[model samples]
Target: MKKLTLVSLLALFMAGCAKNTTDSPTMVGADRDEHGCIPSAGYQWCANTNRCERPWELAEVEGFDNTPQLFEAFCTGQ
Candidate 1:
């Protein structure tokens, strides 16, 4: 009755809290992609370099166009 409802509500609240911590993209230092890149810190996966990188910085160093298409091609090594 009331006890069961209280337990259910508590469980639901805990689940919501857990989900926020695990799935949030805005979790600062805890937010990392599958490749361990942290977007908040401006690091993204670069398949060409096989590491985390800043696209604009990489483009400058590699002498490539800074467009999104070029970045994708370069990052994907296409």
Candidate 2:
């Protein structure tokens, strides 16, 4: 029983060690390369204009509102 348990645990560990080559789901409506910035909400990255933009503003243009504000937001603090 102990050997079985050890083998099962080792198998699980080895399985976990296997590299996952499949691409994972990216951020909705935005990707790191597309935005040219890191993946973070709230003015972290902007793909439309290739600059930092607020997530809230991006949300505005998510569906039908493709206004300028939705493209980018220049805050003071950055």
Name the weakest run of 10 consecutive residues (lDDT summed) in model 1: 19-28
Which pairs clash (backbone N, Cα, C closer than 3 Å) in model 1? Answer: none
Clashing pairs for model 2 are: 43-53, 43-54, 43-55
lDDT of 1 by residue, 1-78 (tens): 999999999999898878444454555677788999988888889988999988888889999987778888998878
Any idea what lDDT model 2 has?
0.57
After best superposition, candidate 2 residue 16: deviation in angstroms?
A: 2.1
Candidate 2, which segments miss by more than 4 Å at Cα? 25-30, 33-52, 55-78
In model 1, the Cα lDDT at residue 43 comes to 84
Identify the candidate with maximal lDDT: 1
